[model samples]
Target: MTSALDIVFAALADPTRREILRMLLEDDMAVTDVAEPFAMSLAAISKHLAILAAAGLISQEKRGRVKWCKLEPDALRAASVWMQSFGQFEPVNLDAFEAFLAQELHLPTDPEL
Candidate 1:
């Protein structure tokens, strides 16, 4: 079975969807306004928005006559946490790595630049 993370990642896989998310970061936008920048038809943009909404990455509501899309920033919490777990490890020291490589190859380490 697919997890929520899987759904979110799938929604984010498309460049068009990622651009839509970036636009929503500034403020909520009408469906038409969101569709304005893209060269594709409104129907195609709507499909991308639908996928984002299904992933919980965005929320859509009707304000008067227009449908507005809002970024649900909290929806990224789980994905962020999962990704940050890898950051817990200490970073590799490049100097140490270079020294080790030199030693393994029986090369002399140059102290002077």
Candidate 2:
């Protein structure tokens, strides 16, 4: 079985997906509303939502004619516990986060090129 940490890592692998999670954290929103803030297409947003759902980071529901997304806070709590255990993750830094994303995405780092 994939661990909660695995779910977290998978859920956080995409920047747009992360933004979706943060938005859901505020409150559940319909699929269209969730996709409205981004330049991407509705399909792209739905794909991100699928990833979050697969990771158990969020849940989806249909009401009448609209589908909504909601955050699963426990998944975040699990991610936090893993971070706390590592003992080196201080206040979030943009550079560090970008580096982490690059690493995750397998981008060739150009330290000097």
Best by lDDT: 1
Candidate 1 Cα outliers beyond 4 Å, as residue runs? 88-113
lDDT of 2 at 54: 84
User: How does each model score on lDDT?
Assistant: 0.87, 0.83
| Weakest ten-residue segment in model 2 by summed lDDT | 104-113
**Candidate 1 lDDT by residue in tens digits, 30-112:** 98999999999999999999999999999999979999999998888888788878875333767876775575445776676
Clashing pairs in 1: none
Q: Which residue pairs clash within candidate 2?
A: none
| CA error at residue 34 for candidate 1, angstroms | 0.3
> Candidate 2: lDDT of 57?
87
User: What's the residue-level lDDT of 91 in candidate 1?
Assistant: 39
Global CA lDDT of candidate 1, please? 0.87
